[model samples]
Target: MPLPKESHYTLADVLSWEEPDRVELIDGAPVMMAPPSRAHQEILTELTRQLANYLEGKQCRVYPAPFAVRLFERPGDRPEDVRTLVEPDISVVCDRDKLDEVGCKGAPDLIIEILSPSSLRHDRLTKYNLYQRAGVREYWIVDPSARSIQSFVLESGHYTAKDLGTPGDVLKVHVLDGCFIDLSKVFPEAGV
Candidate 1:
């Protein structure tokens, strides 16, 4: 049965909200997001460009930040019942069913979060635990300041991570078989 428009919202209300400030909801609490820096946007651009290029004509698709992602959806759950809502720097979703007009219903196939000064702890700790608990297939924490990236793959209901410290390092996406991220191009400091 098709749900009535207002009765059920995957992210419709959140996306169409009048609030200009961006915030993420965790455990039903709103956490304000700081404005991103130019460096942050630049890194996001390179990463998004790489992912988008690889996903073209493929079943999977990529979405950049400002897209809503309601994680851990359960049967008969309303939008207000969802405990976590995040805006990852990049989201790659392979299952079309999880997607809706406003945002994604559950965990994306792969999630990438770029580090910012204000978001460091939130991304590394808070979101790390959330994504792991939600069974996110792959999670990446990109640290531009450190010129490193940590890739985590869900194995046996837990995340096992691999860190690529050098800017020239390349990481093959576990979920997307043929996809690889070349850090050299992702960071301007690479090959320095």
Candidate 2:
């Protein structure tokens, strides 16, 4: 079971935390993160590599996990009021202004979350609604155990499920034009 949230945390509090554990602030609460498995790391590495290669010389850039993202529900919310902070497995940002020395100030163009046993619910439900509410253009949920990738595109302030690909399929990123990832390489050793 997940640990009880420390509900008083904000982005500043999360940043000032002395504990070494990986964590994220969700709706003014602190949620501890589990260490990723080997398969999770491998998948993240490959996806980062592919995204970086595809975005070369482009205005947009991709960032791997441990990068902070502050999501606000309203446009003019103060820093203290902006509570949600996430470290997505992969994030692509096209708006250069959103990038700062600390982290991303707003939603990224694309956010990808790799599902682990510990994060399945939060990623699929909590973060799904959070990203959609914050106006994220695209979201990808990559399930290593299930060997599947699900893509969602934001339309009319809501997410529309666009593609669900298995190991043998290739998935195109709607946010990143002219870029597609081969699912075979995404889940190797699996006969799909």
Candidate 3:
């Protein structure tokens, strides 16, 4: 079920939600998220592990989902006033200052959202625009069914299609400097 259209929710409201279901806040409205499939979980786990390994001893840190990402449009916005909050499948934060006890307070350097049936539209369009506007340096849309990945790099405040690759190809992270992921490892043929 979708969140009510008449109601406007905030970051604080979403955090206070007692329901076990996961949700994201977009434009001050709560958007319910569907449970991920086994394939999705596998890809997420592999990507997280690979990224965590690459970022070890580095300034940047990676986090998996169920993590909060507060998207405040303006400076000095209080937590209660901030409206947008999302949990990308994987988030890489290069700025240590954004790290809080809860989660990231600002946009992450890189965000990877593994596409699921319910999230295709939200991740490709709504969250795409939101992340671009919020200044996310890189965004990745991983398609488990297709066994492919599409990466977008932020240029001049807009996300540009940087790379699209299948299982045999390798994808590089522009924001992570020299880090890259082997597509075969990310989308194993035997798994999905």
Candidate 4:
């Protein structure tokens, strides 16, 4: 396994460095993401738009990537100390402190990652653990190719996942009271 470089660099240092592509830190290790394809961008935009409509004037804020969300080991720690930085396809954060000029730097109340063939493994396994450990109340893994959404709720320090079928299936998100999203409306292809 490749380990993190011993040379400690601040978040500013990392951002200022001429990056060929977008990258995130996972336990101090760098993880690069493929530039989103058109399908991916369209799906993500729809999801963000739906959530924003539902959450408008509400406490929660829905955001789309390339917005960075830093999940640091310690609150108020320096940027260099930040080990996990991700730009989920979509995310909803109700915590004001997590919001900053750059982006959020902690777990959002809810996180949604739209999976592609390139990101399937990392999203299912690696990020599954990371988000759970970060204490995100709810996590949604939307697989456009599969036409399905996997809902995971953090329970007792672990995640409990449920398979939400196509359009008819209303995904009940525990974190958002009365907030249920019909997959068909969210994904145009999933519509009957």
**RMSD, every candidate, angstroms:** 5.6, 3.0, 2.1, 3.4
Off by over 4 Å in 1: 1-16, 190-192
Give each model a TM-score: 0.88, 0.91, 0.92, 0.88
Give me the runs in candidate 4 sitting further than 4 Å from their true place: 1-10, 190-192
Q: Ten-residue segment with the worst summed lDDT in candidate 1?
A: 1-10
Candidate 3 local lDDT, 81-118, one digit each (tens)? 97888989999999998988878988999999999888
Pairs that collide, model 4: 167-184
1 versus 3: better TM-score goes to: 3
lDDT of 3: 0.87
lDDT ranking, best first: 3, 2, 1, 4
Please report how far candidate 4 places residue 155 from its true position, in Å: 0.5
Candidate 2 residue lDDT tens string, 98-166: 887767888999999999999999999999999999899999999998989999999999999999998
Error of 1 at 122 (Å): 0.5
lDDT per residue for candidate 1 within 109-132, as digits (tens), equals 999999999999999999999998
The alpha-carbon deviation from the true structure for residue 47 of candidate 2, after best TM-score superposition, in angstroms, is: 0.8
Q: Candidate 2: minimum summed lDDT over ten consecutive residues — where?
A: 1-10
lDDT of 3 at 119: 89
TM-score of candidate 2 to 2 decimals:
0.91
lDDT of 4 by residue, 8-82 (tens): 434655566664357777766677788887778877877787788889899899989888888664666877666
